[model samples]
Target chain A: MTAKLELRNVTKAYGKTTVIKNLSLLVEEGEFFVILGPSGTGKSTLLKLIVGIEQPTSGQVLIDGKDVTAMPPNRRNLAMVFQNYALYPNMNVFNNIAFPLKMHHSGNITQKVREVAEKLNISEILGKRVNQISGGQQQRVALARAMVRNPAMFLLDEPLSNLDARVRFSARSELKRLQQDLKQTFVFVTHDQKEAEALGDRVAVLNQGQFQQIAPYKELYEEPATAWVGDFVGDFPMNFVDGKGFRPEWANIGSGPYSIIIDSSESFGDIYYVFGRTESGEHIVLKSPKLLSIGSQLKFSVTRFKEFRDTPQSTVGNV
Target chain B: MVSEYNNPRNRKFYFIIAIIFVIVTLIPMYVLIIIAFAVPSQTVAAYYPPLFPSQFTLSNFIGAFSGYSSILQAAFIKSLITATIVGALAVALGFHASYGLSKMSNRMSALIISVLFFSTMIPSLTIAIPISVSFLKLGLYDSALGLALAQELVVLPMTVFMITGTLQSLPKQLELQARVDGAGFMQSLYTVILPLAKPGIFAAFLLSWMMSWDEFTFAVILSPVHPTLPILIYIDSTARGNILFASAFALLVTIPVIIITLVLSKFIKGNYLTSGVTG
Candidate 1:
């Protein structure tokens, strides 16, 4: 029911500009692998390649160690939930969910559809038309349609992005629980770091068509493999000064050898983030328990820092 | 603004204009009905023909069926078959062609559509002679199929334009989703694309049918012997100068168009192009 997916040196290019640069990856069976990247970084393109909607310019795509690069999307036995959900406008919700079963000529379509609808909590809306449902209901219907087929894996391309904030939070948890319940491989793609952290068993940070780091979200946060990964993985950009990189929480603002003139500060309840400049014009952000005013002098010390080389292509631990 | 438009004087003026517009547009149709239902004697009132007939009878309509070797019955059947063939051919060919066109870049598809439109602008009479010659050589002259193929020149361009717009407005994701749901290309088209495009396709079919039903140049040149309804009306009116019979034949020609339009009006209303895809 689940598959282990592999991409071997896959390179995709449009005209002369390459969008995916010789990328190789493996997603284990029943793993929730999240591809996290900013917009236009080929996140969705990678998903399409895995779903067989797109072919890699040069390399092979393998599912369960079997080459499937030449297979069509339907033959690949993968289901994809697009950002807009893409429900059939002409059909009611029941028919929309029953579409895949009908396509496969599977018997007991009504029973199968009812089971999936019950699991997705969309049984009440089965008779409603797609246009008559709200955005959240539409998303559930899309998921039910995908699930009804018992696909080898589910490929989700920003599936939660269209839902409102209130619904998105619940949808996120439901998606994670659904993946766990099915025990099916899921390749989820998103640009939101928080969503990546919340749902990914292992998040792969992609930038400029290459994976900067692929590890557990906690490891990606504590020990990022690249300076860009560190900045991209957290809420705030990691502070780098004098060839030393430290997270905001890793630096203390009370007293130490280094001193700075506070330029600005923002308070979040009991804690504060102070933005300051050193005498050598190095900008640093440090977390403080007490709120500090602007234009004030403060001393800070870095409890721990990663030394990055001064070269333009700075990788982590290049001391 | 609403009050000004609804003022008593302005209301009266608008009412008079509306009445004049309706009367101006409906006068020819009204006269046609009057002549068709009136007896021959009432239709020929010397110098001052009466607007309304003194007596109504089905004599003119009855005369159309019995007069002229039963040509009206034959021509009516021929026109129906020819128009039905043309409508089917245009929709079948246009839907597929437009699907392919919709996948191309906007500039590319536009260039091709404009070329198709340019082909339509060339007068059909200019090519009618050549087509008739080819049809004769192919041994298809004076046949319903030949007439239908010739009328395709008049209807295909509009069908392609309309169906292309409908297909283009649909999100490509639906088809892609269908494929992911274990469907082949043809399956996705029928299951997803065709249903969404029903309204446009029906509208295009209706227009094609009406155009083919009324087409004169191709019908006259290509199938003069096996004349369509329009040709039958022309022959009866010109040679026999039977205004009453011609009016009855013309009225018969409009029956199918009216019925088809009424039956398909519900399909054309509120086409659900934007509902499935979120903004």
Candidate 2:
């Protein structure tokens, strides 16, 4: 019931500037995947590429082993929910929902429109114009419009961002339930980490057009593949220590005056930095919340710390 | 200082201005209506001795409508047909052109739009000879269709630019949603762009039609044989020595347009002012 979507080292450039670098990720059949990032992080560009509204400068996009790199959005058989819920203003609710069926050479437009409207719980609004509807109802119409087409892949770019908070939460849950019930491949993009965590089966943490990490939400949040990913995935993202080290420091773990034991595998140095617990109840801000009695002084290695782009003065009571 | 709390003072100030404005504009209309009922000789001199007509009769209006052969009648019909057709065509043509212009890259489109506006300042005096000669060469001379076409050409750029401006201001998400919903080009335009641009379309058509109906120099130069209402009034005034007849004729020609504008005034917005007709 679900389709497979794969992006192989996709690159996008506009004139002299490139918005999306060589980026790749995959959404297996029936998986709800999300590309999560900050505002100008090329997340929407990736969604546009997949939806075929945009073409990659290099590499390819594939769905179910078929190449669709050069296809127009109309030929891609993928539906997208735009951020602003683009319903036809000239059309009433029924015609707006029926538009997809009409576009794709379907005969039973009425039946399909009715079905989608009923499923989305917007049947009552079928007679009304788009401007007359509420935001959440408009969102449902957009969703229904995208769904009515029976497309292979669904590309949603901040689909629920326009909704109020309570509506957003419910819409997300409903979207997830719908995706599961339909068992279709869904590639959703959002700047909100919580939305990604709640909706995506696999989350791709992107920053500055680069795929910093891609894994199931748990692994991406708990064990980030890159520093950027670590900083981006969590609720209050993983704090970073304003320091560095090499293998030389870690090789002589206890040899230094301030000895803190850390798993030195990822720390590309010989005792540059470490995470170890101390006598106090505080955990190392850099290190995981593991209780390691490294000594009285090296307690949690709680040193000069700040969040990403945080001011030093703010760390006073922030500790 | 609580200066804004003086409601009585504000009302008095506004009332005075309103009275002044009403008197300034309405006094002329009252004089004209009175002249419209006077004898031809009295129509001019006694028509406006600052109020009542010294000698009252409907002969001036009846004579204006009939004594001028069927020329005035033909001119009135010509102007009506031309204005209505021109307004409709200008608006219809504006829709597609504006859509394409608005959806294209913003910077390039903006430059193109600036150039279009710059061309609007082109003096009608300069273009008149060229337009007339071209129409003659193209075999569209002295025809109602030709007159309508000329009027459309005059109004098209502004209408198209206005509608395009409206379309640009519309949120892009609406177009995208229509596309995602499986609407093709026309469907998307009708459903999304068209509905959102109602105010612009209404304003553009009414304004363009008004311009076409009352335009004097263009109608005089291009289609003197098939003159519009404005040109006909000018001809009558020049042939005879009655500015009163000209004024009454001018007022007659202006009534339909005024009715249209007044009725549509409520809905005519920036885009409607610049784009196409409602239908």
Candidate 3:
């Protein structure tokens, strides 16, 4: 079953240092919400707060309109998959999946575990110890353990981070499919913007214990709400000139008003990413169709950009 | 150069050194066995005793268990029961205490553990009198329960230190995952933490048991009337100069230790502390 989750002005601090500032969020009953931020940006802390592992310093955590802020993690009835899977090393795959159901005294554990195991394609390994399984299979067992209970929501903390590149790619799609098929609320936390874009119905970009922007991944990439979000959300940090920020693709190289001396370039098969410094000494990266020689000057034109300001009240829309 | 050190000549030299080390360590135990098996006439009359027993007999062991109201038999049972209880209590109490400490800040927990370790530095004799006085006042001086509790002072520090290491080695995420999986605190502890920490807990138990089994100072002072095996051995050997009987009793004390070690060698070899949390 799915449940809408809401945090009303949650702020979590440990003594003198605040790990999460006053923040609020809402996830629709069946939406896949991703919290995307770099490491040490309180992304994991946010998930812990929502899952009731760490209490918020000041705020109410409401699940389906009921306050659960003071409830213990078990009482909150939410499932979480840790970054490391955290499968019971003492139990086999079958028992690991059956643990949650047994905790709730849910009958028919054998059939339930088999069903979820089959769905995850891990039925064959049900008799194997967790340590005997591959990382990919362990991840599936963690998911199977989570899904068996059909909790109100699922909170994932970088669950795909430990997988190899190819496995991670497949696991990401499998996770998205699982969420869609179940239609359950999933709040996933990770440092990878690519994963956020791939899975999130709405991505909240966090920085310095606060959210910089909460919007769709496309909106975040095209029109980041703040300079920090612009710098963080893309493969290349957005280039800023004279208090205005623009993505690398927004600047056309080799024939424009602004001039820069090429420092280096990286090729990506069809195109090159040229890195250089402008006349005013601002570092800029621009996309180039041809290889650009180092030390050669190039001109670029900004097709679109957003103006930023020292104060938070500055207009943030694209110009 | 490395291969030169690994030559057959050097290898033989190392083999000889290992044999010498083993002999040096085992000499006292070997002599104890020889003395235990030697006939009373051979042991008492000989000025410089032979390395091996001149004659073998079970009379010393039988005499200790059956002679003079059988004090050794009663004391043997007392020591076994007390040690087993102490082993269990130490593990039970130590694991809980260590789990609580493990949740604290590393510096805070380390400070507490160091304080616990310092308690062991004081000779048991210093506290034995005060403890026996307290035990007398509480009517627990000669009781096995009291002896077991008193022995906790000897074993609890080491137990906590060891189990704390074991608990810390396990990933904290597993416990958290158990909680999130709908298990309550005690439930998760029993279902996840306890099983994963078995090796360390058993090791701590075994150490406590052996320590209590051979403990003398507290047993002599607190339970003088009933007397643990070590105390009985002390009294018999000194009061009667029964070297043969004492050696037999000493050998009897090591039997359980040996059997326990053999049985739990599997757990010791598991190396669970280092490898418990695999990805």
Candidate 4:
């Protein structure tokens, strides 16, 4: 099957600043692809380039195998949910959601709006102004607006970043479920690795306008293609020690080559994270099922280690 | 003393300042009212003006309204028509121009906006003669439409600058979202931008109308024959020395502005006018 969205050698620059440098991506149909990156990494710019909100300095953006690089945003047939949930503050929830349908001159717009609102579970607040709703509800209204059009692909730019932590956690699962049920191409961009892991079928770790690695969360965690990717994709991330990388969970109290003095330990339910310093003064964390007290010296061994070349890109994958 | 004044507990100081402000503003209007109703005998009897009307006579108002009723009526209609047209054109042009300027690069937009602000600083009298001569040659000398377009020269710069601040304050993503949600450029402008900018636009409209309604140089030079309220009032008071009639007309002219300000003051923010100029 052809990819729903494709960017070929897209290079975006403004005067002296090059935001995205020679980037390319292909999001297959019915896949939830997340672009995970730190801020100013050109993740949002990539979405803009795809949606035709901003033209790439050099690129050919393809939608369903058709070149739409020269086309305007409306003709591209893609819906974007912005980072700030850019719902029309002047319009009520109903009009805000129904705006796309009205623009296309869709028949039975009210009925269609009702259906989308029902799906998003925002039917009750349809008459309230956008500002009158909570941030989470405003987010749903934005989603409903995008979904009402039934576009070929969805370009979401950090749609859940504004929600509270409790809401964000639930919204992540809800978003994943929605994508699973709809099975449309979704290209979600966010800086949060946890969000990307939760919602992405495959997450691309982007940094400084380049894709460091793109793979499933498990693969990205277990087999990072670059040292930067290894350090970026996990909760505790990966700690670099003596020209090698390893996850905290991979090291535990056992017979090993290195010994460390435990600085402290914290417990979260079934697991304990023991933070310590190695003999060479490298900070390391060991995740263990058993707890260890502070100031206790323990020997630890890594089951596996990711060896990386000494470069800014930190090319990885040698075990 | 300064400390005492600055203290939050100083209710007496605030009351004194309030009384001073009310007196300062109301005194002129009170005097105008007293003179407007002064009978012919009272005017000739005293060399100095009376604090109160010695005798309130309806004849001054009757003479003012009936003698120059047609001229007043014509002036009233013309001023209303001119202000409304100027207000509408200024707002429409300002909205589009501000939106366009908002999309420009920072250096370019700032340069252009600086030029606009600079143009407003040049006195209207400097260009009044040239504009009047050109209007005469163009056969636009004494028409309300021509007057309105001329008034736009004064009003558009301020309106555009103010509306630009408002447009800058709005998030760019709203328009981008509108475009991705299937709106073309024009569609996004009207549906998303214009509606979102309603308060600022209305404020711009009110300011334009106020400017046009009170505009003297353009009205006096451009339409000397078809006088607007300000022109007629000026001529009546200064040239003809009809203080009573002019006071009544001046009072009449102020009513709409006062009403508009009172009704729409919340939308007309001082910060909205100057917020994004430097930023």
Candidate 5:
């Protein structure tokens, strides 16, 4: 999959204070790309820029090779699900789903709504007002509302944050399946690394308004391009140790230059911080060792791992 | 932990307040209904302690409604027109202004809020004198149009105050979602913003209507030919011998205002405390 949507130097500023820096990203077609970051890291703002609720201070948004930088949200052909769900309270589930169709003036509005309602398992409550439905059903209606239009891109802003833990898990799986089935791009914004890892085809690690790295979920986890990305996308247990940034060949955990291996030079940022730890149950950290076997096509069935460090590492800008 | 004594004290306090409240409230209501229906007796000995009407008939309604097409009916019609005109104009302006204000920067938002507060603080009476002068000079004085326009200065700011609070409570995500759903800005406002803010709008409309209905100072000073109900009652009672019919005419205005308040009571959160006191 290649970029179906791209943001070129997108920035958003409020008067004197800039919220989203001159950032850029590419979301591949038919792929689930997550802009994962902590709160106020501009993940949501990036989604907003793509959707055109707010214009970039200076940037261009390209969709399928065409520049849609100045286009309104409707013109962008991107559907969004908000944290609040934003289902119209006055409209029933059926009408809410039918609204976009009616706006498009595409016929078969009823059949379309019914098809989506049935698919989303909300057909039973199609006649119920949004306020009268449960939170999960409201979310379903919101999703259905976005779905009925068949938008080119789906921009979700932590839509499951309000759900209970159990519901969140279920909605997550269903969402993944939906994306796979539709074969449409899904750009999700979330703080949870687990969510990004679980759902994303590629995860774009963002912090402080800039993207640290964008890679496939497993690659991002295993070989983070930057230390910030490593900390952000850490799922497998790996002890982060304290060490100064040094030349990759000369970087050491102890006395002399120790053997340090990386998948590629691209993962080697300007500085390399070495770390290592000892003992079976005791904590350990090292300048990450070469994650390779004698064979080039080796596969690891191992699922759990942890990281430990002897001393504290510097938490500098852009990690 | 709480004590049982707290409950007893609360109950005792409520009992005392309830007794005093009933007496104070019922006494005026009891007297107004009586005097409004009764003609003043020629003799001082005619003052009798009767809770029920000795002679109940529709004559009071007829007497209040029929003569010279009556002070009550004309005034009622006048206030109705003034309130409808002022309320609609004020609410429409206030509703959009608040939405515009909400989208502005904090400093600019502060400027708008300060303006709203400042306008409300300077009582209408302070400006009424100058406005009355200007209107008189412009040949706009002593007309219902003048009265209604003057009432707008009061009603507009109030409408904004109430509606702005309602709009502020609505999350910004709703609009963003609406935009993402393909609604244009105005479409989002009508389909999402207006419906969500309806409670506040209804409440503001009723309050503005009341302000226009009960606005006596301007109505009295401005509209000489077409007096609103309050002004009509004041003029009718003050003009020497015609004072005899004042109570009956006052009762007529009272009836309609009460009915409207009752019907729209669900939307008006603080109606009971402010109704008579404000007027």
Candidate 6:
């Protein structure tokens, strides 16, 4: 199937510094594509390129197979939810959601606004101003405003970053379900690995204006193409021993070759991590279901380890 | 621990300052009231301190109001028309200029703002003769519209400066979001930017109206044929030489400005801009 959005060798530079270097990707229709990275990794810049807010210095942005690199943001027919929600402070919930429809001069605006508001479960607070509602409701209003246009794709720039932790978890699931129900292309950007692992159909790890790896979360974690990708995509960062990758779960207590003295153990509810050092004084963590006493000795075996070459640091900018 | 203001010594200091402030500000109004109610005999008979209205007669107010009833009515209408036009024009033109200035580089914005500031600093008296000559040549003299246009030039600089501060405070993301939601430039400015800028515009309108309402030099020079409230007040005070009449007219002129300031002050508090923007 043809992709809904595609970037061809896009590059964005500011004077002497290049923020996004030669990068390209395709987001298929109905795919929940995520660009995961730490702050200032050119993730938001990439979204701006697609939405036509920031022009790429040299690249082509195609939406539905049309080159839209030169198009203005309003003409791009794509909606973006900013990190701060960016709701019009002067407008109430109903007017805020109906803003897009009024822009297009779409017929039956009241009906269309009501329909979107109902779907977003903000029907009761339609009369309340955006400031009167909670942050979660404001998020829904922003989403409803973007949805009233029914654009071809949605670009969310760290949409849930402003919410509390509990709200963020529930909002993540709601966003995923909403994407599934609408079957529209969704490109989400975030720095949290849990969000990328839980929400993306295919997660792309970006660093310093370069796409390190793009694949499903499982493959990116279990079979990372580079050492950087392996370090970036796990809840607990993957351990590197002698330039080789070993997942915490792959280490087991046995009579194989490696022997280690237990240093400490930390528990995170159901799972515990046992910190240990090999005989040669290499630090390693063994994932265990039960707690282990500190300062104990044990022989451990690694089921397997993945060998990865380090992607040279010279190619990407200093950011 | 006790707050500084709650201490006895500091409380005494505040009491003294409050008494001084009240005396300084209220003395003028008290004198004006006494003069308005004083009888003609008090001034002509003897130059005593007419601090109290010993003989309260409605004749001074009646005489002052009746003498200039026709001129006062005409001047009141002319001033209203001029002030309203000046306020609207200042807001419409000044808002757009301020928004444009807010987006410029800091050095450029500062340079342009300073230029506008200096333009306002040039006293209106210096330009009054030139403006009067130009207005007479252009056939714009003796017209309320001409007076309003003249006042607009004076009020616009301050209006634009105040509006620039307000626009700078508002986040630019709201406009960007409007653009991404499919609004054109003019549409976004009208729908998104102006509504959020209501406080600044309110303040600009208030300042513009107040400035034009009490303007004296331009009203005297360029508008000799079409006198405004200030010109009539000038005629009543200097030519007629009736303190009671002048006091009554001054009070009349102050009422509307006070009413407008009270009503629009609610909108100019600067609290609404950040209400729904930040959590």
Q: For this target, which candidate reaches the highest lDDT against the unseen true structure? A: 1
lDDT of 2 at B245: 64
TM-score of chain A of each: 0.95, 0.77, 0.96, 0.94, 0.76, 0.93
What TM-score would you report for chain A in candidate 6? 0.93
How does the DockQ of candidate 3 come out?
0.54
Candidate 2 local Cα displacement, residue A102, angstroms: 1.9
Say which candidate scores most in TM-score. 3
TM-score of 3: 0.92
lDDT of 2 by residue, B41-140 (tens): 5556543454444667765676676776488778888988888888899889987788889879989787777776664577766777788899999988
Model 4 docking category? acceptable
Q: Chain A of candidate 2 scores what in TM-score?
A: 0.77
Local accuracy of candidate 3 as per-residue lDDT tens digits, B1-279: 578668999999999999999999898888788778877656666887666665889988778777744676788889999999999999999999999999988899999999998878999899989998898899988999999998899899999999998898888888888889999999999999998898898899889999999998889888889999898778778988887788888888789899998887678654433221344
DockQ of each: 0.70, 0.26, 0.54, 0.44, 0.25, 0.66
lDDT of 5 by residue, B87-110 (tens): 788778889998987787658866
Q: Per-residue CA lDDT of candidate 4, range B1-279, in tens?
A: 577777876877798899999999999887777667777556535787556666887676788899899999999999999999999999989999999998887688778978877756778787777888898899988899999998888789889888887888787888898899899999999988887677788889999999999999888888899899999988998899888788788888888889988887876643432211111
Sort every candidate by DockQ, greatest first.
1, 6, 3, 4, 2, 5
After superposing candidate 1 on the true structure, give the runs of residues whose Cα lies further than 4 Å from its correct spot.
A259-264, A267-269, A276-283, A310-319, B1-27, B34-59, B62-69
lDDT over C-alpha atoms for residue B238 of model 3 = 92
- Displacement of residue B70 (Cα, Å) in model 1 is 2.8
**Backbone clashes under 3 angstroms, per model:** 0, 22, 0, 0, 14, 0
Which of the predicted structures, 4 or 5, would earn the higher lDDT when compared with the native? 4
Report every candidate's CA lDDT: 0.89, 0.72, 0.87, 0.84, 0.71, 0.86
State which candidate, 3 or 6, has the greater lDDT. Answer: 3
| TM-score: model 6 vs. ground truth | 0.91
For each candidate in turn, the interface RMSD (Å) is 0.9, 7.5, 2.4, 6.3, 11.6, 1.3
A253-292 in candidate 5: lDDT tens per residue? 3343223232221123543333322222222233334433
Candidate 3: chain B TM-score against the reference chain B: 0.88
